[model samples]
Target: MELWFTEEHTKDVRFTIRVDEQIESVQSDFQKIDVFQTPEFGKVLVIDGYIMLTEKDEFVYHEMITHVPMSVNPNIKKILVIGAGDGGTVRELTRYNTVERIDMVEIDKMVVDVCVDHIPQTACKLSHEKVNLYFEDGLKFVKTKENEYDLIIVDSTDPVGPGMELFTVDFYENCFKALKEDGILVNQHESPYYAREAAAMQRAHEKIKKVFPVAKVYQAHIPTYGSGHWLFGFASKKYDPINHMDEEAWNKLLIKTKYYNSALHKGAFALPNYVLEMLEQNI
Candidate 1:
């Protein structure tokens, strides 16, 4: 018999992948964690039956989330990452030599430990000298800080379970307060292709727009994520992702990326008409 893993994207829809081997399975304080190996996606990390990342296409997500804001503001020295327990977000952020300090607050330390042992590709840089890992609630962590970080990335899961508070308006306000005067915030905005995900996406955008001077949504295609069309939220105090993007300066840095590029940076913000309509409905 063959073992396969399935994640229900909706009541009637499911995604199934063949599992080559089960590496580890544990019940953490927050969620169920599983690591598996597959022929196609390489190593896979699943949390609460949801596919978090795979070695094959993880670059698309980690790069898009980190590079977009970094390219927009090359001077981002201090960064706070919320809920990225897998450490892929931190790995990408570590590539920027200009970044001086990284404060990563992950609610579940088991996710980090499992990823470090089974998925080293994404978790390799979690121990970088500049990184300070905190196994605490990100919501309460942000509430205690003010005008400290130049960039804040909320690399959280779906707005459910431990991630629920991270999407609330109060959390967005706390993130806004935690940022410096010219700070930028990039977060995992839910997808717009499905009804449930679209509703969450709209609510997040509406709330962030109310708190930040500039708020925009950009997208990337991650095959494992629901509907293969994932969106990221970009909210800033002053800089605009497109207008402030220094293509020449970014290119001069000679950073090699698989998904994010200067051209894609501008094109990503071109939301589809239907997505635009959805956002407009909330406005």
Candidate 2:
């Protein structure tokens, strides 16, 4: 018998990966966490039966999510990251010396601990002196903050289970209030290739547009994720991701990234006609 890990991307779609061995598995207070070592993707992290990241392609997701907003506004000093328990997002943010503080709010502590133990490649920065970890519900965390952060990254999981609330209009409204006048909020906006995820993506974009003055969608290809085509939401109070981008200034920092660059930054927002059509459904 062969042991494999499978994730249902939808009712009719499933992605499976061959597993060399199950490294670790734990039932956290919030969800089930598992780590597997594979010949193809190296170390893989799975949360609640959903693929979170893999050693092979995690860079694509992390870099695009962090560097896009940073390149657009390089002077951002304070950032609030909600739900990136793997610490990959914080690791990328810490590369900027201009970033003075990072407040990371994660709903589960076990996810962080497990990632720290089994997936240190991405979890290594969880204890950086600049990062303050808060193990609490992100929805409730943002509700108490107002005009406090220069950048807010909602690196949440799918809009299900504990993450369901993070996708609501109320949460986006609270995020709008939590950001400074020029703050930017970037989140993992699900894929558009599948109808199930596409519907969620459309709903997210529609709700965000209602709260932010400028809301746009960007794309990146991650092999382990659903359909290998992932979308991210960029919402800002005043700046347009492309028009306000400081390419010259960002390049001067000499930050090294595997999947994000000045050229890719501008091109990521060019959505296909089908994706554009879906995004324009109600907006």
Q: Write the per-residue lDDT of candidate 2 for residues 1-283, one digit (tens) a residue.
A: 5779999988888999999999989998789999999989999999999999999999999999999999999889999999999999999999999999999999999989888888889998889999999999999999999999999999999888888999999999999999999999999999999888899999999999999999999999998998999999999999999999999999999998889999999999999999999999993
TM-score of each: 0.99, 0.98
Clashes of each: 0, 0
True-structure lDDT of candidate 2: 0.94
* Residue 44 CA displacement from its true place in model 2, Å: 0.6
Q: Which stretches of candidate 2 lie over 4 Å from their true place?
A: none
Give one digit per residue, the lDDT tens place, for model 1 in 191-273: 99988999999999999999999999999999999899999999999999999998888899999999999999999999999
Q: Worst 10-residue stretch by lDDT in candidate 2? A: 1-10
Candidate 2 backbone collisions, by pair: none
What TM-score does structure 2 among the candidates reach?
0.98
lDDT of each: 0.94, 0.94
